[model samples]
Target: MAPIFSLFLVLITEFSLATAQQRNSNISLGSSLSPASSNSFWSSGSGQFAFGFYPNGDGFSIGIWYATIAPKTVIWTAKRDDPPFHRDSKLLLGNDGRLILQQGEDPEKTIAGGSQIGSSASMLDTGNFVLYNSRSEIIWQSFDAPTDTLLPGQKLRQFEEPNELFSSVSKDDHSTGKFRILMQEDGYLAQYPADSPNLVEYGYWDSGIKIAGNNVTLNLDDNGQLYLLNNSDNMKNLYDGGNVSDKLMYRMTLDADGIFKVYSYGLNRSDDDWKVEWSPNSVHKCDPKGVCGQNQYCILMNQEALDNVVWFNDPYSILSNTSRPDCEDECLKDYDCEVVLHKDDQCMKQRLPLKFGRQQNDPVITLVKVGGREFKKEKQSKVLIASVVVLIVAFTVLAISGVLIYKYRVKGYKKLLNSGNEELIEDVILRSFTYGELEQATNGFAEELGKGATGTVFKGLISNGKRVVAVKRLETVVAEGEREFRNEMKVIGRTHHKNLVKLLGYCNDRTNRLLVYEFISNGSLADVLFKSETKPRWEERVRIAVNVARGILYLHEECETQIIHRDIKPQNILLDERHCAKIADFGLSKLMNLNQTRTNTGVRGTRGYVAPEWHMNLPVTVKADVFSFGILFLEIICCRRSLDPDLAEAEVILVDWVFDCFDSHELDKLVQDEKVDKSKLERMVRLGIWCIQDDPSLRPSMKKVVLMLEGTVDIPTPPSPSSFLSSI
Candidate 1:
């Protein structure tokens, strides 16, 4: 009797806790919940859906999944690329209306944000997490952002032939997979290789709908029917499942096996839970468009015979080619290449025993001779041993040198103090902190903010909740890394403009190189300008443009040492609470004596925004930065990215399109924001055209640019910009 009573009590307690999760549907601002605590999730009113962390890899990913089963099926994830690094993680709704994910006592990352003040978050009974503004309007919702899975009532919009969705790495692995259902430029939705977007459009499963317009929606109904909603409000059935019990919930998912499927399931969770209702492609495992081994073909006997394939001990990565969008070029450019196995543009070069399969087909294989010699792998073990020995010796040397460097740095600072130069000492110490202090402030570096080629940034709180700062950790601390570190330090020490983000402090202890800066409530300019559903007002656009020009003007002139910002683009420009622009990321900035006009250097800036001189290898100057700013200026007015894929053939390049609009007397079409004053808008466009001229001699200086934007200088009739159409 005692044992029975105890079991009953345990079941009752678990039920009560689960019930509480549904009733308390709110996650308040500045607070976080973690799955490791057993109460980190909130359930829908009927307990049908739940939002929490799903454990995978070294850490867990924050996702919304079905809660009634043993193995949860994730419907959506906040950050597919950046997942929480620990079990003791929490999801926080910040005061600024951003959805932040943080690992236990670690740095925090902003996964999603609501662009409204006084907004609050609620996990709705319909499995939607919404951020509601003060007027009770939804500022942001989880439904607007979909991952690999799509639930009933959710819609995928195709305003401009949108292609967005990725597959899970494997049946058990939730990382990136090679398959995707994408919308091609030819008005079709098909399953293609995720890594290759520009290959000839081919897929095993396509919607087969040839529509006349781009405004359409792909949605699933409660009865397990997939339909397309055109510009009209009518639904056209694409795939029908006849009839299923209305009680069963259905979901469409892009699985790891490169198959898109719709499955039906219900509560109680039977052994064979998910019932497949619809599959566009054949159910055979080989029918799905999966990646295959390089230069290898299967006999296609049966599933059992699939295992009778060869593999290599040392398999390289997806041998990617930087010159082209697809992998074909990478295989051909390599010295040791013998065969290029290509499928949807994804290539695998075969040198050793072939690797990979479950890739849908025997790839379109192409073979080529390298130096007219055959390939062989021998003495591999000896090669690995020698590599390890060299690495160990190199690390030892770096460690010894690091210690000597640290002593000199500390000694030099002490000398300033001993010499009684209080100003110099104060300046150095004011922007200095021990590595441990930053580590503690960031809770063991748990939350990642953003990552770039050079370093990764994390969100941090200091002064006991008073200050929020962004902390950047460089990938390495040697050679190029050291140069970037000192360059930033020198540039930041001299400049203090209102449009420049202030550097709070820095950490340089041994191999660790970190920087701390004030956190602007609003994020990057690229973030605001590139959103598919939202656009900035004309007034805000002009303000941001003028303010950014002012910041650049200050760097070029008003400083004690003239600083040339070599990289000036939307991502490097940040916005503050007032929506004012601030130029950040000074790692690429160069200092010159007041009279120096230009200097020679290698290519540096991003692909789309780099100056034309980069291609010619001419002496780089401040005009290079001016050229980038001009491109960004055009992007702001048009409300389009520099790399837009939705334009007609004639308007393929943004700069070329602008010129076409000017020549055709279709300036009205060039200005998208209706509220913009036409004369001012045309003047702005003309200024942008002049700033991006091919001849550095023709492009206006930054000082004159500020005057032109302010309506102080007389505007000039701009000529056509030199043709520069290079792909990234």
Candidate 2:
């Protein structure tokens, strides 16, 4: 009887143990805080965040979104790159204490993997999804890895260490986009294009200015402003926000168009509502990246400077002058550019260079939203300053002297010709030829090398190779052009500078005018600077910069008529086989008595290369040429075009950007091209900045510009240049 009773007790205990094992098998505990089911994953008790195989976009993923708030928003994602193959994908704990995402029935078919060491998945009150192991060790936490949306305590950078950044989601799709927010080597927290290894470089401030040691806290105030706080004391305000203190939550994101936005949330809101906050892009279409070509500046379309209010001009664009018809053609050649013309006003902008590094030349300020919709056409309240003017977006004005020369040469106004009044050239030799002779000799002008403002330059062998010369033909003859043609010949014929293109002979036939010059086999400097096929290397670039400086010096000081190559830009600078720069395009050239301080005239010269004083109706002097030379110098140092679209956001117009670095003594930042040698490059950047001082009296003379290029003259530190006012 006793043996039977013992057997009965053993059976009951076995039955109870079997039932408990069955229920436990269906559920697993990689963490004891909350057990995970075969079909469902659990979030820690705080309810601030949740992670599960949630439905998003077209598929599902183990994603974390805010659960405590009314509106759910995904803040962190584990498998953002690839989604689950099917709806049966499960998140479960393994016997080996690992968190694995298994597809369908196969538990080993891992879709995602996480260390189960501390494998308890919990949600912090700060909306952070943290996964820890049993020993109280954090294995993977959402705070350390952030997506596009940034939380209050999360940092946009890893201090001291550079280039560390967070990823943002592409539009609609949960996939990561090609933009990142990171700290640059130059000590600025920069938003970089995915393909661009350098900063997407919207603008930079002094991020290197150290705050109060390790106890510093980065605070995103209620307004969109981002601040660095040392303990309880404010150290530095990193971002410039007008109302960053009004909101309860703030998040900054890299938008789809590569623009960065700072968004703010109302009280106790889950996802923050955002406004423009700040955008690096222009409000007026006129000041587009490439609207006025290589040397032109874009004027603002609207007079007002406010956010969300776009200036109105038909087609939303404008030009600085209406003289250069070729400006349109030059603008179209840029890769990431688009042109819009309205009522004679033209605007060009970057076409959202989807490929990274392509839009570096045209930076736009993109503002994104976390809770609200992306910025689209909407009614924005703005204070109207004044009546809307018929603002100009694009126009190309010819030089005043050039225009005068045209008027004086008109057929009906023969008295203003000034044909024989040669003020600069002493002994004038004149030769006339019929159209037939020129056409026959050069094979119908078929041996054409290139064209300039004056006319086409054809390669011709005169006297059956007695001398091979370049014949330049002036196609159009304006009423006042006769005097300009005469002045041009006098200036080049008498000037014997090695840096200037030499004039050999001349031909004038009523409407047709031709000048013979020494033939240069190599092409214009524009080709070498822009076209990669003929791109000049570091050594070649330095030599070209030095050679051009010498030529400017000759025009300003040594020439019989102190000449200003008014249209001084890469396109106007021609290169010889040895890569020596020769100053060309004297059509816009100005002549002044030697050592004269000023000459008043309408603004001339290419856009980006023109000096700021020229815009102020000030006297054109050697300092103007110095400003141009400074632009060219930096172009050579960076191995990029002057007024490049890439540096647009940094507001890096040639002189201003260089002077900023010079004032800071951050010379190494100018060597943008990785291929260039560092030691040699810094010297060139320093020299270039010195040549472009704002005060005309403060600028170095061309004689000094040449000496600095030659590594002989020591350059004093340059003062900060005035910020370039946006023209578009």
Query: What tens-digit string does per-residue lDDT give for candidate 2 at 311-399?
Result: 11112133444323333443454432333221122232222211111111212222111122222211223222113322322212210
**lDDT (tens digit, per residue) of candidate 1 on 1-728:** 99999999999998997678644765667766676787777666666778767777777787788777557778787767654457766777778878776554433565666466636677776667777777868887788877787778877766432245678876566667777876433334566666542222224456656343446677777877887776767666768844565577888888776778888886645664787778775434443333442333222332322222222212133453322224545654666555444333445555533322232223233333344443222111101111111111111101110001112224322322344233233334436767998998788899887776558888888655445788888774344565666666756765667798867778877788788887877788988988635677665687799989999888877765677777788888889876789988764345667778666556766777889888887877788889999999998878777766688776667888887887777777865535445677788889989988989889999899999998899878899998874444
What pairs collide in candidate 1? 105-443, 106-443, 107-446, 107-447, 108-447, 290-359, 290-360, 291-359
Q: After the best TM-score superposition of candidate 2, give how far the Cα of residue 174 lies from its true spot, in angstroms.
A: 69
CA deviation > 4 Å runs, candidate 2 = 1-435, 475-478, 481-488, 595-597, 646-648, 651-669, 673-679, 725-728
The estimated TM-scores of all candidates read 0.46, 0.39
How displaced is residue 270 in candidate 1, in Å? Answer: 5.1
C-alpha positional error of residue 115 in candidate 1 after TM-score superposition, expressed in Å:
1.6
lDDT scores for all predictions?
A: 0.65, 0.53
Count clashing residue pairs per candidate. 8, 54
